[model samples]
Target: MRSAFLIAPLLMMLSACAGEPTRMGASTKLVEAEEAILMPPPGSFSVAGITQKRFSNGLQQEIFLSTTSAVPGQNVVQMRLYGTRNDLRYRDDHLRFRTVTEAGIDAEMRGTLPGIPMKRSPYLVQNDYGAFGYAFGRPSPTELCMYAWQQLRTPEGEKPPFAGFGAVQIRVRICETGASERKLLAFMYGYSIIGAVDDMRWNPYGPPGPVSDRLGHSGNPIYPPEMTAGAEPDAARPVAVARPARRAVQPVAEPVPTALPGAERVVVPSPVRASSAAQPAANVAPASSAGGTIVPSPACVGANAATAAACP
Candidate 1:
């Protein structure tokens, strides 16, 4: 009776474990929940204090931080714009590329700043001329360029802009440099969403309802002289333009060297040459011998008793 009771409890414990799901069960549910939510509007927040930086090759980099309405001491958004530099400093060619046309902003964000939950797709964006190729953080059509935005989590121990407001929108614009050069330009904007503000969901640059007009324009809060200096020194030696490498010319094949003495020569038969005049056949029956007159021998006649002794 004691042994039966022990076996029943052990069997019941194993069944309970089989009914429960694994650790990944919770992650799968969260991903499904995130996909169902719609992206928030750009007009929900505002950004200010745009800054700038540049490379030696005249490439520009800018960063715009978000502005809060009532929330204090909270960095709701932080945007960075710069020439394409690998966030992974360990890469062989770090910061050598002039643009980030191929890099993913979401992956870049997660790598640079951890512990922040960001959306993967379906971001909100609007431009003045409607010339933007990509509204989301996806690559553009032509050069694989793109513009993207995502929601950022608010810091802990601080109240959000409003109730249920945990994320702030960050916008990034990467387009052509507009110069004759084929380089790219990047613009990032951070905005803070407050609940108390009117929930007017609209394109910020379309009608200029609430956001600032200088969203895309340059030359605002000009950079200091020292900060604007190029990466290369002013008095550095001029770099020589490198010419393309030329293909090696193949030499013409030369005749084989004259055969050494005692070397066996391959005797190839020469074809018979055609003559201007046709000649009579040499194999025809001859009428006379060249050396003397011809005569029939006894052997030419059928073998008889007299013919057998001598040829005709």
Candidate 2:
């Protein structure tokens, strides 16, 4: 009977062990697309999916997938935003992958990210949000990839609102086929943080700084070079003035003399001026030939003659 009881307990223990669920140490939940904090413009990138995870230690992670595919397989463009009440230590240890940490450490030590069996270079990017350091690589002959990470927290000496801790860690991995670096970086520039924790102290972005004194003051009108002077605020864009087309000038043809039938053609040469020391020739008037053609005098052949002057 004792052996039977022991076997029953052993079987019960084995059944319990087999039925126990695996502990993931974290709770994962599917979140709505609208709940995402980092929102890429709908025109350029639409949210295809989103996953939200809450760690036991109070770290929140939200990952967004865009409609554009990063690689040939099922992978898509991914943007991960992590919010922690304290510092980024938790993320570095638990949230980030081992390879990503190694890449980051290599970047810190070597001034560049270590490529995963490929060549990669550091890419610098800045926008209205903040400046970010990224690593760029070409995964294939036609595809390009860029990875960037940024952490936002209150300044070291500055006190956060309500004496509360606030920090945000952002990670982006984007790839495109036959896309330029500028096109890939445009996502970094256009993404906006639309959601935040309800607490006032959980502000990833601090108070707005004061605007420049020169802005919106007298003699500080802001206008582009293409803007016309004295344009009204509600006026339509100025029309471009059309230039007149140039007229091409045509050449005039010289008149040619025609010879009478059965009459020989005569050739004429321009006369050259005689030396002043030579005696002047006697005047000889031009005579009309039998065919009523006026013939030039011999004296006039070698003398300077005006076009309208009578031959002499």
Candidate 3:
């Protein structure tokens, strides 16, 4: 009875553009199909399957565990330990001291959780690595303090150039990430998941500035310059690399028809152009009946780009 987690669906996921409502029965069928397909598999471990054993004599132990399934193409391993932090920000000192490590290895931590004594191992990371950590903290009648984190791994041992971000062919034994954010077991449900992209240590020093350059923006005032205080200005900042929009566009190579077929046929097709900078006020998305916020697709910003309020 140590955890209380739930399977969460991607409720707020970006929706495909809607030209019209699906036929009445289609939406209902979609829900039933998802219900049949999205249930959690059996024997899934919530906390990386490892737990620390502490005896009355103060004997400490670590265990390697497994989840119901590890995602395909994603590297994962689950191990449990014993420890706690005063709060959530993942203080370096706290992580360094609490995480169990062999004498010489320095483990990096990405984020913290409440009941589960978990922190991402950022210390073991490669250049351009990434991770996500979430904690289900102290809950109350009307409030559940949920904390989430996403971290990028920094290169630690300095592999070859291609190894910097190339394919490493890792054999991920297990992963506990589920289909929904609300998929929690009634008992032993308190837990977290920290996913690393390349490495575990999050110290990406570039990209934000380059992103600003791409956005043709000076930087948002909300995130003060001091936020990047120690960041080497020459090095890039990583915050600006939010996911770019991806849309499916089809090519129409056929010509258009004209009324005067015998004499001549008029053929014309619209051109595709990159979009310009969006107005600051244009960020809000319309609310769906399910209360989901929908955002616009990413359009390229080029001097000769086309301007469309929304992309379908």
Top model number, TM-score: 2
Candidates' RMSD to native: 27.0, 16.0, 42.4
lDDT of 2 at 285: 28
Cα displacement (Å) at residue 1, model 3: 70
Report the lDDT tens digits of candidate 1 across residue range 76-158.
Answer: 22232222332233324222322233256655544433333433333344332232222322122232233354433323433
lDDT by candidate, in order shown: 0.34, 0.57, 0.30
Off by over 4 Å in 1: 1-48, 69-103, 122-312
- Writing each residue's lDDT as its tens digit, candidate 2 over 1-312 gives 889988998998888866435456335667787777678755666776776665422445445455354454322333333344433223334444222464664454233223433344445657776666666667567777666666665565665547435566676666667878878777777788766666655655566679989896898777776677687567598999999999999999898977677975453422432222143344432343445444454556565544224342
Clashing pairs in 2: none
Better of 1 and 3 by lDDT: 1
TM-score of 3: 0.16
Which segments of model 2 are wrong by more than 4 Å?
1-26, 56-59, 62-64, 67-124, 160-164, 215-219, 223-312
Per-residue lDDT over 94-198 for candidate 3, one digit per residue giving the tens place of the 0 to 100 score? 222232233212122112222323323333322222333333422233222222323322244654443333111111122234333254321123222231233
